[model samples]
Target chain A: MQKQWLWAALAWAFAQSAAATPTGDVNAQLAEMQARITQLQAAYEARIAALEEKLAAATAPAAASAAAVPAATLPAPSRGGGAGAFNPEVSLILQGAYQHKKKVAERQLSGFWTPGDAHADSHAHGGDRRGFNLDHTELVLAANIDSTFRGQATLALLDDQVELEEAWFQTLGLGQGLGLKAGRFFSGIGYLNEQHPHQWDFYDQPLMYKALFGAHSYTQDGVQLKWVAPTDVFVELGVEAGRGQNFPATEQDHNGAGSRALFARIGDDWGVAHSWRVGVSHLRTTARDRERHMESELIGEHAVAAFSGKSRIWLADFVYKWAPNGNPKDRNFKFQAEYFRRQEDGRLAAADEQGLALGESGYATRQSGYYLQGVYQFTPHWRAGLRYDRLQSGRQDLGSNPAALQTVDYRPRRATAMVDYSFSEYSRLRLQLARDRSMQGLTDHQVTLQYIMSLGSHGAHKF
Target chain B: MRRFWLVCLMLVLSAPVLAGVKVLATVPEWGALAREIGGARVDVFIATHALQDPHRIEARPALIARARAARLLIATGADLEVGWLPILLRESGNPHIQPGQPGYLEAARYVVLRDVPQQVDRAMGDVHPDGDPHFHLDPRNIPPVARALAARLMQVDPDGSATYQANLDAFLLRWQAALRRWEAEGARLAGLPVLQVHRAFGYLFHWLGMQSRGELEPKPGIEPTSGHLARIVERQRAAPARLIVRAAYQSDAAARWVAERAGIPLVVLPYTVGGSPDAGDLFGLFDATLARLQGALR
Candidate 1:
């Protein structure tokens, strides 16, 4: 028996070595030995188990009862359904930047109504903390909640506060090309508005977005219904109803929704290598007391202007992407442009730092802005981009409060050029230079170096 | 006008019966396989062509639209389409083809995978936890995948069960005979050492009894750096490889650099169907690959 066992052991070792090394013809030999080893090992294990059971019975009759008592009281084994088994996909995005800018008196959009937060560009980490800055660090978690729904949440960690940027659940398999989403999410009014800052081609938002949507672009706590047409050409339509509680609109008291939006998109492949999309969207909301920041000789040092009434915005966006043979790894070019026009008819109230009312007026204005940008990935790792932003103040009719709700003659415009390098798909570094004339009479030349890194789950980007 | 209306009505009436199961395949190889099994009973739409890297694909609206209409979705799986497939499935809004459903078929699940990692780490350069997803290169792996696909097709389109079974049997016969021919032709390539640009052809090397010297890249998915190439060249000088091989989709620059420095011929294999002019289908893909390897070795 000992000799046979030794032979079996030797065979097992040989088979293991054979398995470890890649030997083409020896596969058959290894398999035969593996079979013999399995038989010997199973037979020996069965014998050992039988012997152990007999020994246990002989040693102590009370041992079985004791084991049974604990077994009965123990919690039932998990059916592979628990928090430990279900791991949600988690991703953390870290962004930081260094800025060098030419000094300007006050950072404000010249031709449009600037929000109180306008001086602090959304890209700036903490209120334009000039030199080195830590941008928004985002923690994102996403998972299929069940068979019917999938949920995602994004938490933005700022220097001083942690904000829930997006928390929403979307229907997964809603048939007939229909999907429903509810909770707080970015409003899909424009292409760039839906994309987060880290996904932007440039380091900063366009002058149009900055002047119109304030520091944080439009986000709504609402419900959205979208339908994609079952056709060869891509066609999508969506509508949203939300509580108008952010910038463009202030918090409202009524239970009814304060904001509504309608959007439609259509796109198609031009060829094997090119694709394009065009979309139009409209958002309408009521502003209770939307505050704007202004500093003019008329209102003195610190002036607060509040506008309350109807706010309506219309946006048209177009995107064209080209990749040779539809493979973007080597090289690709993307051209994107959006035109935004806003009309606000409201009552404007101006108050100084001392809470003294300067003036009140019926404000009516037609303002429009557009941005054109092109990003080219010259190689697998390097990309260069150029963008131009222009905003026009069509007509501002401040009935009784002309001095309070002011509109400048200058047009807000900015030109930016940037080059970014991706070390891998998860990490990127960018250097950007821009000439900004958004501030009435001031032209600021800005240089920014930024880095973005992603950890954990890989997020899919929507085109 | 009356005749035109009558013809339109007749065409519309016949559409459902004539139209087969709509199948969306994520890659050209799977697309070709779906065609072989599904035949005319299925209309296969390939989401990506052979020229594109299967690992990276944009979830384009065009793909989503196609997915929306597809009754069945086929993927290589084993995380090959992990980057974009989930997003496409979510956006497609097609309930029938969602995961764990009858209409969803992951080909890798049916085949025995190679190079399954003991531990997964991204630092290993995009290593798949399940295994290398390039198993289609080994022709022996095709039968099981084909069988699973036939089963899936039958399940999704019960009316075409007879056709799917017959097509699968016919495909297996052709595939078995072709495998024998490939094995005979590949006999001369046994024990030949080759440098691979990536692990894309790991199964092919194992199938043909060829030996791998090393990879051009420092790690999988990572591009070859000058230092890495120099190291590969230095190692090749010590233990020489016969040839340098790269997939047609991969750029030849790095492989060429290593080949020139190490004094070996560089061969670009058609990694999948339609990857090269000669490799128009599954059979052609293997035939072209074997021909190129044999030519380079000779």
Candidate 2:
């Protein structure tokens, strides 16, 4: 029995050893499989890294070349790069108008003798003539001169003359909320004074502007200093010292500063939809030997008058804008009004047809005028506006000669209505109709069809 | 002598408090993001309100004053604020924030843009040749912009690099978790067709897997003609969009018109941080957007 048990135990031991062999083999197979997986993962990762590197290398030069290529096909590159790298922002504005008006041999404001209307060269400066007319062509060039300065030049081409509308260099990085501008520029006397003709809401100048500042508003060679206050509401104060070469001041030899102006403006937002701005401005200038030409109906000849004196003008302006929740894409409304009062203390010398002095007299005149207009954007691309202008002659005094000049009724008024359609922001077509009683005892009916097109790069207008 | 000494002391004491970097952001969303990254190290000023259309803004003296004082200017770029910002910058005379300077940060540079036109023409209606300027709507696009912004902050204010990195990391952590939650919650929104008033929501729709079926405007800035509206109506009838979407700053007239005709609900999404009452901050902006979208789906 002992020998049989030993043999059975040995068989059991043999069976256990045989079972352990396969289990060890299974564990070895599992370890091998795990090692193969890790090796495969590393290999795949290296391949991916190599492929990515190759792809990047292949695209790098192509991307660089693509970036270097100029996008000239695009309209008006805003940045200083590409094909027109050296070119400034150049924009050409073409304005043309066709008007129908009654035949008036001479166009003149009776009591107000202004410098802008003194030139009898052509019908371009007076008003829209009786046919298709090239109102003006404005060529604007604006660029950054350097890190410290930016320059802009606007040349206006009329029928018979070329006028430099604005040429100035504005300072950059002067700090302390202060800005300085030097050269010939429009004075910031009123809301509309600083804006160009193309930016006007109405087709014609207001009666107040025509009577107070002459046909064109005040543009003079000047240096301006402006300071903006650090406040929640917008507040700005500006002062200008100019050479009085334009209207309101016709100082022939302006070796020194002959014109000075001061203005203050404040603006704020009422809510998301409404905003308003109000401003007050004052201008003072001295005129010496200023020539003005007038047609004498009684003598059937032209008379030249030379005046010398002090001119002071005061202006107050207000503008309010409302857009539905500040989105003006669909509809908006703007109402603007400006009032001006002028006082001129000077002497007038009239010359006869034979180059003889007919009379020399001291005269003082006080006049005030105002215009209010409202523009409504009735649709996305259509707008309509209505304006009313009126003038009041305050007082006139001819020093000693009472019979030399008759007291003429000088209260002038006009009403204008206009509708415009904009094909885009750069182009618009307008139709304007007005009844002008600017001249005493004469009511002139005028109709105008105008079109304005902007050719190249144009910066956005300031509010 | 005492009064002079007192004034001097006041000026000396006030100098340090005012020494922080002044940053100006064109929109409220950029202001919020700048605040998050800048924390206590910067003072941020937002130029335009959320309710105001960024395309047009008045060149107010207050804006010029703030711009004049700002050391850093952050804008969405791509000519989104082309109308007023150029004038403001020129008038401010602040060299630090001028283009090509280190202090100027354009958020659009870091993200891949959409709707880049092949040819730029006004007939195309004010298309931005650089692409769509409204890329901030996508949550995923924020990380790269934030990273770039952090790098710029480090370059501008190297002394605060560590703090900026920490802030950015923390923001990314929270943002990643939020993104995961949003993705899960918005998974059902995939394949849902929608209509938009403008192409402003392209990035958001792309991220959410929502399909844009049509747009209200025939072109980018052009008003839709009657024929275009008729075509949109016909297309909607064929495919049937679930909702019509518009932004808070956009006029709702066209969207309402299309929605009423198509028999779909109109949803006004907060396009920026402060665009809606519920969208008070960055997180709230996304939360409110998702809620509105989900509500529309329901």
Candidate 3:
């Protein structure tokens, strides 16, 4: 039995050794396969590198040839530093108009003395001149002052007279959604108040704007603070304190606050194609030595008055826009309207050529006006617009001066229709026709053909 | 007093959890890429929708609000957003995202731009002097832009560097693999003649080695005059193209007008993420684009 056990153990050992030898052979085969894969990978990488080199070589020549081609007429990209680097983006807008009206007469609104009533000064009123006119030329210069401030200045040339339109410096990086703007700026009271004349959709200002703000919108030297809330819906609040030297208020010495305004706006998108915004604004100012000349029926002569007191104006505005699928390239529509009510309480002192005040009496006046317009872009380059304006003068008491209180029809309205073709965003040709009944009894048919062209870099307008 | 202190402590503790770098992108495609590269480290906001044209945008107050809070701003920036971006930057009052700042990243600076005009006159209908700003159509251009964006991201948020680098490395691997697959599949598309609506697809055509037969628009923004259309139709009769291509945001009337007359199919490619139902994200965007092109093969 001992001899048999020894033989079996030897056989088992032989079997185990034989199995281990095959395992070693399998390991050798696996190593060979792994080495083959590594070699193939190296070869593949080498081929890729060669192809990449070839691609680089091919593209280098093409890029060189392209760069060698001169692009003298092309405006260089606006970068931080280069020759003329500190020079601001300068843009000049030229506006010319040819006007043909049925009657060329003194323009007057009879009922309530409008802020921009017929003034003898040519600069005080717009649209009064007839025939070919170089309406206005606007020159704008804007640049970053440093990393912390941006400055913009605009000069408007009207009838060969240069007027400082706007000059402002705005702060940058004042966190917490706060922004500060100082210097002369257009007051943000209504939708169109801040827009320059070159950006207006029509050739003439709305009748209501003409009545309240004079042909030019209210601009003042002021400091403004604005805040935007962090929310899903857009909400903004702004306040301004200014030196009142514009239409509603006469020029005054810098003493206390002359004008102050507060405004709030909220906006949101309805869908992919529609957006709307609504805002309410309130403005208050003290008018000191406000002057106006009227043909007094009592004396049948030109009489002058200087009034001093307070004026408060409230404005509400809404805007709606629709573009198919949020793309305005083909078709879009914009509708906007603003309503304003003014309350004036003051005393008027009439002077008869002499420096002596004939009489001083207290008077109160209430007036309101609104304008609604819609512009439709039927195609990429063509647009048509229509606007309706109406004004209502409420009760006006001339302080017991029966002859001075001339009661003519107090309602004035106007309708305007325009069609414009934009060659590009910077150039447009507009033809406008209007029936103006702004004067009491006269109906004027007015036609204007205007062209606006812009040169150089101009910043984009806001929504 | 103890209760008030406890509440304040809780608030302070939770502030860091909610605090992340805010990034604002002008278009949805850039927003998607930002989300990918800035994973878990950023809050991304897109200024314009996929269906909106990049050439023009309203400076809406909501966009201004977003710009005010953003720590980083990424734009295509060969003047692609010139119509509104400058005003938005001025209004935002955020100096960090202004030009020449570390927080501003213009993707066009990293890629080789195409179709730079020799002369820039308005007579050419609003041509970009810096060349075509649509360079992201080529997948190969994404890497350099991605690297630059990664560097900017690090500069903006150094605490998240490792996370951003790891994410970028992974993304590069996947993007490279996908690029290879696309190249293999697109090999048959080389030298194909095609018609385009605008110069928007110059990079794509250059990548696929396709030849541009003609354009639907006479110039970039100008409509095709009848005379131009007649000439194009006459030319197509002699040398026909395989198909007509347009981006989702472009007007289809002109493309359809020419395609019908020339007897070629019209294909509207999803130019960016969210442009089509099938293009849900970056991967899906390229997949849908390739599939559409392949399906249009003659």
Candidate 4:
């Protein structure tokens, strides 16, 4: 009996190994397969070991004859299914580039000067004709837990610095079309900021983004209470609290450090083929007394805004990607774009008031600009894009104040050309050359090239 | 709300006689196979629509509503419907179709996948790179998948056990016969090196004995760069690729660019249902693809 039992156990283990391991590099999928294989292999070994031991033990006459029993065939059970299976998705994105310009980064501004947040000729000062960091890497992890909840965490190593991109949880089974999301995540306040910024078809962000959001780039650690309104139309609403941006020191009556903004966006069911969004944000921060510092317009923005009373920011933007002559997925088409803007009145206090320069800083900087871009997909995987940026700078008297940095005068115009090719879902490469002669003292000419590689199950997001 | 009532009404109107077995299918291809096996004794409906991108499909009131009334549910979940199928499974709340239940069948479980990536990541643009999700494109996968489906369906409707087994047996014989013919036909077309715009039919090529020299696009989601295409073209010129392949809905820019530059013929293959008018059915899809490839290569 003991020997008969031994053979049956050995068969079971062999069947187990056969079941583990499958094709695919999904972390969750491969790990499960590996675990199953180990378990089965162990079980099979023990069973066979026990069988051999039993056969040896049954060598004595009566048991030995009966031990010559039939071998049992066990069912193969190495499978991945049922509940509680976690998917570990691994991704690697490498952006490599060859550039023809010198390194250009916003030199860390002097503390409390808060002036140089302008798209003016003086914004870069002697920094023009400079080469810049061309390579950036972004990695993300996201998974849905059952049907009601999902979480995502992303880590970015870009421009030689690493930061958490997104760490948030979403509740899907809430009120109709309502999703409760919380955690420190990217504020979807701007157009290009929301999508893969580094993956922008162009070599750099539009001129408008550089002016309004500051050269430091945009990100705030705060909580956002948002909802997706129920309807055939796609609507989103959000309220946030964080370090406020864009306020001149002269405009605030209290601390401008803690900023707050409420914004909403509505898009048609048709998706990016055509969409529009508008938002109004207000912020305030405590003023820092930089009495004796050589303060630029960069630092004194909030102090100036606070002193000026009632700080606010109003923004509206729209994008319409049409392929009217042919299919949206194919064919050459024109990419339309436009945006309107205005700054708070009297927020632009000059340097004597410890604010921005005439029109660059604490001055109430009035601004307006729009652009037209067209992308023609000459081939399925090949596309060429051209865009023109026409912009206006707020005059020191009318738009400049303490928050504005320099004397606003020349409003530079920009034109760019981009050519790209997509090889597959995981890899792509592009080249861009453009001239930024729109700003004063900033007649910039440069060329940037980029390549992105995605390996593993991470490629699914491309589809 | 009234739309919900109308959907329910339609289900009631199509209510089958309890005498026949019932089967629920996830895709149209699976639905067709189930009918062929179950013959007059089964009823089936494909839950997913052909027009939708399989990966990004959203499960709405209608699909969830249909799954609840069905006795069996079949899906191609290798994270294929990462966006929605799981929602339907839970919301349908059909105890009968829950995972590990007698009625739930994940058809892709039976076969091996090709080009399984060693890693998976979101930055790769919605990758399932570990393994290809287009398993159904390869007809050889159908036999095992159909067998698994038949077994699950039979287990659910025990009274129709004989009918299910007989049907499955017949399918196996017919498939074996057909496979032999296909084998002979495909052999003459083996050893062909081609470039595919997308890896949509990686599974099909694996079983069909064709070699894909490279894909037109450099990466999965990222478009090709001029430098990359120039290199691909250079590679083609040296060894000379025989064919350039593409899907109907998908563009052929990369293929055309390389084909024109390298002087190779590009074959636009039907990737999915309705990829082309001639590829109306699953069998026809492969046949059309093979014929086009062979003709181009010849």
Per-candidate iRMS values, in order, are 13.6, 8.5, 8.5, 14.0
Clash pairs (backbone) in predicted model 2: A173-B93
Please report the candidate that would top lDDT against the real structure.
1
Output the better candidate (2/3) by DockQ.
Answer: 3
Candidate 2, A40: how far from true, in Å? 35
DockQ of every candidate: 0.21, 0.21, 0.26, 0.10
lDDT of model number 4: 0.56
**What value does the lDDT take at residue A230 in candidate 3?**
62
Candidate 1 lDDT over A172-246, as tens digits, reads 888998889999999888888888888899888887887667755688899999888989888889999999887
- Report the lDDT tens digits of candidate 4 across residue range A1-463: 5544655675565446444544544577556656866676557645653453343333311112221111221112324434624664556577666667534443221112234334322322112334444344667777766546667776766544666766777664453334455665655554454445544656666665554443323344455555544333435566666544332321223443355556665543233233233333333332232122233455543332222433344545554444422234344454546453545443333344534433323424456556667677675567899988766665334243334433436565778998988665456778888886654455667686767777644522210
lDDT of each: 0.82, 0.77, 0.79, 0.56
The true-versus-predicted C-alpha distance at residue A1 of model 1, in Å, is: 37
Give the better candidate number (2 or 4) by DockQ.
Answer: 2
Q: What are the models' TM-scores?
A: 0.86, 0.84, 0.87, 0.55
**Where does model 2 exceed 4 Å of error?**
A1-81, A116-126, A293-302, B1-8, B15-21, B151-163
The best-first sequence of candidates by TM-score reads 3, 1, 2, 4
Encode model 2's per-residue lDDT on B34-121: one tens digit a residue. 8878788888989887767787676655677688778788898988998889988876767778876767878766555678788777
Off by over 4 Å in 3: A1-81, A115-121, A124-126, A295-298, A354-356, A402-409, B1-16
Arrange candidates by lDDT, descending: 1, 3, 2, 4
Better of 1 and 2 by lDDT: 1
> Candidate 2, residues A98-183: lDDT per residue as tens digits?
88888887665656765544363232232636888777789999998887888999998885678888999998767666789999
